[model samples]
Target: MTDGPTHYPPPGAPLPEEPEPPRAMTGGTRPPGPPAGGPPPPPTPWAPYAPQGGGGPAPQPGYLLGAAHKPGAFPLRPLTLGMIYDGAFRLIRFNPKATVGAAVLVTAVAMAIPIVITAVLTFTVGLAIDASGDVESEISTADAAGLVAAYGSLLLSIVLAQIGVIFVTGMVAHVARAAAVGRRMSLGEAWAATHGKRWRLLGLTLLINTVFLVLFVVYVVLWVLVVVVSPGPWPIVAWGLITVPAMICLSAWLWTRLYYLPVPPLMLEDVGVFGALGRSWTLTSRQFWRTFGIGLLTVIIGSIAGSMLSSPASFIGQIAAFALPEYAALLLVLTQAFALVVQNAFYAPFLAAVSSVQYLDLRMRKEAFDVELLREAGIVS
Candidate 1:
């Protein structure tokens, strides 16, 4: 180093001056070019591709619905028939006297349609028979049976149509509860929801009931043919062995397939009739037995309740030696209709609510539907 300073020919020739001590690299006085030794900086934090908001995200219906899919997931916690009882109890608890009063009011309003129809049809036919009686002075057995059968069929159809409407109303109640946020729903909200989907619901009921009615007609035809062609006990035996099971199975299959066949999805998704049918079929296919048992139980219970409600009218008719048989029959018919409506009231919301719950369950199980639901609810970015 000393020799380089003494023997340097010129300032630019051979003077090195110990290479400038390698130029220390500090944060403030670091070299302008590459650093001597330094590790790369850490990468940035992960930022979700989500829109910014005050809250992280809000809960979605789909995600809340997803809770139904887990191994023992019940849309209503502590699930059982008791749940239905509890729900109905809640309806009354809100306004003790008013709730029962409202149910009675609605029931009375609904019953008037059928009651009027029955009374008018009875009087018209009675008058016709009376007019014919003047010519013969006696009613033939065959004519009497024919009149009774025809009237029964007419009344049956009317009853079914009214019952179908009540089911539709119940469905609307379930949908309202499902779509609610932050709180449970009341009958008023349920009625509001019912009103919105009333037309669509009635249309669905008509389509499904029409199919069932056609099947009933076929069953009737076969029964009549058996009677006409083979009056022997063997025809009865054969039908019992073959037709009964077939009818039962067919009814069960159809009932299970269409059980929850239309509802929240129809309301929520705005699906057409066939699409709702298809979705219901898909959802119930795997759990047919469970559905069947549930349906069978419902029917049995409903029948029992309906019978209890209706038993009084039948007993009264048999006991009373009334001067006017027609008036007595009218009383029985009205009582039966009122009882049926009450029995129906219990099962209506149960079926509708369960179906809606099962619909969401299917979506959750098959698709990662919780994700979509969360996205919709704004809970997930």
Candidate 2:
């Protein structure tokens, strides 16, 4: 966002010239310098970089190779909206082990153990309660143990599922980055990328959602207070007239314009949590609407695609439940879990790929990162 170069020189750039020796202010003694400009150090390799007024790097003609230069998921240029979506799918195809595969693996592991344990405990407990004749009798220790295990396992599954999604997103983000320049990482390699950063990423993901949720709860509570304390219909009118509109406006402004934009920076740029938040904020400046629109579109697309992929199982489950009420509960739970796994597997990586491409696309457009990436890919001579 500054008027200076937004990037450091590329990897092979020469070091900057050393500063002149300090001159004492006590006397007018000048420091000796380069022997009357005797051929300055080979003009540093960064010579090719041109800095635009707003931190953009110089153009590299070598990168104009068009499709020939695109070795990865999408072309190595500023992307159109459709290209972003296309890039997401291409990344999945190119690196399934790191994207959808990882997602499915994590979701299955996260859901499987807990669901089985919870189901068994709940079923056995239900049978015990049924045979206990008096419905009002105090719960036995065995019943309490079963209930505790059932509830705890369900709660544990949710936590694991959330953590797994976050970790998978982190892996997918890097996969998108590597794919931009024709790099491929194995499943273990992608998992290794998040070795020390998962907790930080999780904290960041929670911070954004938690802040928005607190704000929403506050708005609803205020309306409830107004309705309860006020002795007239004015509070009801105000709730409709003010509270809902205010909540929607505030949430939309914060969530739509900036949701999850920071995750890529945290993952790819290796910035701290707050640093990533600041980076995303600056990157989206003057480009908010484009990013927001792309994000909204991806959500719609992913939702439709996920539903299409997962809905059949759900419909079948409902039908089976109705047709065989005796086994309905177990059948429903198993079918719903399968449907969720199918949906989560598809959605997580798809959304992450879009977000990663959007981040890279923004960088390329604003700071000539495409030139850097082109050079990294050896496309730019």
Candidate 3:
């Protein structure tokens, strides 16, 4: 493992700002071929992709990143489904602080806006609905506005949650990429790297949401056409049975192809939103089933696992509510929030890990990536 007293830059030092020729994986530069019996470290997740640097005896940009170091989590070569799963777990276990800890922080912050908004509305509006449905309170303008504000907050929370997922996935992806190279990112480094690309990632998130919305609008139009043309129980049933399932399939296909693994490219390559989109789409080509299978299974497993963890809290919350009915509303809100937090603590990071690993795996398989001069790049110790 030792590169012969190579005097590798000690681990934990600041990564060099100037581009190492081999470290830049995007230019006319050719990487020194793969190390004997090993793959190269992946391209550093943080690099300037704005323009190619020129030659003046100084190094140029664009090099193959190697995953060749004794993998902190996963090997650099093409990976199997089980290996990807194993690597995600290994990453969480080996780098708990950056993985689980960062996940917790992101979840809490993201949830905070909704939680606080709900709490204020609940206390101020005083639980607008009566569980028994016996109240006949007359409506007031203030109450109506409060109701609108409450629902608006709910909608805002949904948007925030999606943004949170994207942000945290990118953050965890940054750490996971480093781990793939036998390195762990400190919390500070993770934030610095991920936050630097926040606006670009946010723009991507917005674009993705808009795409899904367009799909929804299409589905609605088709449904309207079916209803107007056929207007029968059978036609309705056919729409439900055929149209719905087809739409679901389309969404799944699009998820795996278009937006699933763009974070690493956005971070590793100096691309704007559209560039990352195209890069991710290209990387996932011809591996549709493999990527889809892995992603679908991961989501299913994460859901089951999250439910198992969250169930206990919910059950206990119900029990507590029965024991103290006076505080039922407050108790229910807290319980739901806690359950969500519990679920996200593990699921979000796991998904992000799979994403980062797969991104590198694809690079190795499709682009022939290999790391040659990691020490010279100022990060191999």
Identify the leading candidate in terms of lDDT: 2
lDDT of 1 by residue, 200-237 (tens): 67677778889999999999998988888886988788
**Stretches of candidate 2 exceeding 4 Å from the true structure:** 1-64, 122-152, 322-326
TM-scores of the candidates in the order shown: 0.54, 0.75, 0.71
Judged by lDDT against the true structure, how good is candidate 2? 0.76
Residue-wise C-alpha lDDT for candidate 3, range 1-381, written one tens digit per residue? 332333333335344464343354556765566779898755554343453565344332222233233336775667887778888888888777777787676666666665676567556655444455321124466556655665565456546665777777777777777776677777677778875689999888789879999999988998888888885789789779987889999999889888687778987778988999899899999988888888888889888999999899888877766665544445655676677778888888888888888887888788855242234234444
Native-to-model Cα distance after best TM-score fit, residue 215 in candidate 2, in Å: 0.7
A best-first ranking of the candidates according to their lDDT comes to: 2, 3, 1
Q: Which residue runs of candidate 1 sit more than 4 Å off their true CA positions?
A: 1-105, 113-164, 167-176, 179-182, 186-188, 222-240, 310-341, 357-381
Residue 42, candidate 3: Cα error in Å is 53
Whole-model Cα lDDT of every candidate shown, in order: 0.53, 0.76, 0.71
Worst 10 residues of 2 by lDDT: 128-137
Candidate 2's TM-score reads 0.75
> What lDDT score is found at residue 47 in candidate 2?
22
